[model samples]
Target: MLNQFLDNISLPAATVTSATAEVQYWKEDLGGIGTVRAVNGVEVTTEAQGVISAIHFKSGQYVQKGDLLAEIFAEPEKAQLQVLDAELRLARRNYVRIKALLDRGVTTESDLDTARSTLDQVVANIEVQRARVDQRVIVAPFSGVLGIRQIDLGQNVSPGEAVVSLQQLDPIFVDFSLPEKNYATVKSGLPVILITDAFPGNSYRGKITAVDPQVDSASRNFLIQATLKNPKQHLRPGMFAQVSVQIDAQRKVLVIPRTALIFAPYGVAVFVLEPDENGDQMIAAKRFVKTGEERGDLVEITQGLLEGDIVASSGLLKLRNGESAIINNQNQPPENANPKPGNS
Candidate 1:
């Protein structure tokens, strides 16, 4: 009879373990490798067919727009221009003489008109020859570094043939790709962090300048381009880069320790401690919480429990709804649970 009475009064030693839930911020990092390249690259070419009489600029030299890069032999075009100039002078003299004669009634109206037409033709020819001379001199179209010269001093080059390569190094571009799933999260003007093996311990910050509208069919990733201001010219073309994009900042949500939750076939649940009628404590039940995104060591509980709830973190797996629990004051419960009436 004594054993039976004790058994009826004794509760199972609650396998109690302490836990506290708090709010925390979480971040997810995604990684991708990319290649650095110039935002503008072009093959510098000659605009007219001629012999390269003089190379004005050396290879690997920085040049500004309209700076002479190479000079072609324009002697033939210049000689033609001289002949046209002489012809134009002669036409002007004839036109003047013809007008004087017409005023003096010595020449007909048709004679004066013919002389005027000849003068106009000569002027047009002179302009065409001048344009040909201008084409023989090759100039830089934009500010950039020139590549190796392809022709020697006396090498004959045809029109439209590549003379060298030029690239704008400052404000270089880094092209990378990200999964199509993150397409909506990434957009123009978002910040990016770039690192490369070539420049150890250095990181370049830039913004997304462009995002491809279409996702690649094979990889299902979209190409993204970032314009990094290389004011120091440290970033070089073709260098590999590791890129990170900062999507957005999210407010920290209420998080619980991962061990606090019990997963069941029906739903996920946690045990809440509440006072029973005898001033003892028992495990109250809160069931079926919806979970949000999880970060390291903690999970966001979206529903079913408030921030201040005293949850049985460790012994939840062995808990039952309305089961009796011993309030061992070994550890204080979370302060948020003990609400002041005004504060609550």
Candidate 2:
């Protein structure tokens, strides 16, 4: 009766695809939130307290270094400059006349010295007047884009009062912070990838330019700066950014397709191929695996999976433990694990 019952029971094979868990290159990325800033930025301010005389640059204008932006009340200083120039010329003429007379034994040495002293005093006065006149003019310290105009014509601006904001947007800086544990891993020149809400679905590439020497005691994180090229000026200062730093070079690791994973209430598992009792046919053996970072279609298997071990890539819903499997590699999915959508 037992032999007759066993003869009536038939075993069926399940068709599935299998992939070898081989060593593939993997990179460890450290992620952090950052803010965009200009490499050189400043609030243009007045050094001299005077009424504005003329405005040269418009709001949101691109200016070159040393370009005049505005001018204060300089009429008084300019008039003093003219008086100093006349006095210097008159003193110089008197000095030359006195020196000629002394050479002819007609004028004393004291007279020549007095004329030379007068000429020197006038030259010094001219230099002081020139400096006073320059103080009224506001010039851009560096080449950059200007912000909104803060002062109007005939407005009295005091010293240290903000006039405008100047920022060099090209080759901008991104400042981010990393944990203290990753201190040794991060350094200058590491490649960085940035994304901001201002420009969605786009990535900006840059490299680490500076790393803070000390870590913050409160947060135990250190600051790092990366330089990104902004030729189009799409990235503005003070914008929020998400940053990823590739800490190390790509190294080989055991990897498998993500479709192979079976989600269970207990843990994640996968079906691996094993030999049957006769050693001729392959059977599915459920394996609980520890997973690491995931890159698109591929996942890093940290435990319970070895290199060269074949695992099921698809058709996992119907598979059972110790069940017969038929691997078909011809109809496998594309192996491109990580596909960049909007990155250049």
Candidate 3:
């Protein structure tokens, strides 16, 4: 009964956190969703169908162009080559003998011509057989990092079957699109920044490499592609990324921490703190404000607040107009224009 009577005459002081309004120059950014892609991507396949005799490359191996990747059984093709070689040697000897006899006028010229023709035919047959053997050997078409191996030694595979995936990781491409209204704002050479959930707190920088010449009729959006350096291959294909580009020059803005704003149905307001007569306790005065754009943890105040003005950042429910405030700022909320949140 005594405590209630004392509270009616003079209310108890409320503890609250405080933050100061400031002017900061920041540029507005154009943001969009993007997808990471490899510069060169393909499923490596063999041209000939046969049993896998030798697996030259392991899974996830980095290979260069023309490097031996795998091999198919070609014992029969190899035997054909050996027989062709022996026949070629015999044909050469017979052609030489016929030429010598014709020069001595001991044999007819027609016999020499026939021998020469026989030698040419055998040489052609050997070339054709060698080409068949080459089709069995699988080699890398380009330099890239290989994916998981699909087949093992002695596992028969058909032609055009994928053995593994190959992708050139360095200098990867990021594909995104913007609305047609922004088509005039974006162009080549503009800087691009990308962030992904896979690697928080890390941002990749690049420049716009290409812009689609025309917008899609269905979506009414134009595609934008940028090239990012990925020497370590940290960025991979099919990764979702958040892309941003600075659209215009920086502009100054008056901002306060979002926590300072008192959200109400009628309007948004804040408790502006002013020194009382005693110069010890602060008087919190409620002032309605007009807000503009919002940054990470800060909100812009277009009206009703002056720069360098102190505002209540916490304890809004307890704060009342004309009430005294004990500014306890030791435990303040996060107040930053740009915040990087972790998955906690």
lDDT by residue (1-344, candidate 1, tens digit) is 99989867845647555455566665544557899999778998888987899888889999999998889999989999999999998999999999999999998999999999999999999989998999998899999988888889899999889998888999999999999998988889988989998887789999999999999999999999999999988888889999988767656677776667788888887777776788656665666687876554567888887777767766555666777665454753333321334432
Candidate 3 minimal-lDDT segment of 10 residues = 335-344
| Residue 107 shift from truth in candidate 2, angstroms | 3.8
Residue-pair clashes per prediction, in order, are 0, 0, 0
**TM-score, per-candidate, Cα-based:** 0.64, 0.72, 0.73
- Provide the overall lDDT of each model, using Cα atoms, as 2-decimal numbers: 0.81, 0.92, 0.92
The lDDT ranking, best first, is 3, 2, 1
Superposed model 2: Cα runs more than 4 Å off: 1-24, 181-185, 255-291, 294-301, 304-344
TM-score of 1: 0.64
Q: Kindly list the per-residue Cα lDDT of model 2 for residues 171-271, writing each as its tens digit.
A: 99999999999999998999999999888888999999999999999999999999999999988999999999987677677889888999889999999
TM-score of 3: 0.73
lDDT assessment of candidate 1: 0.81
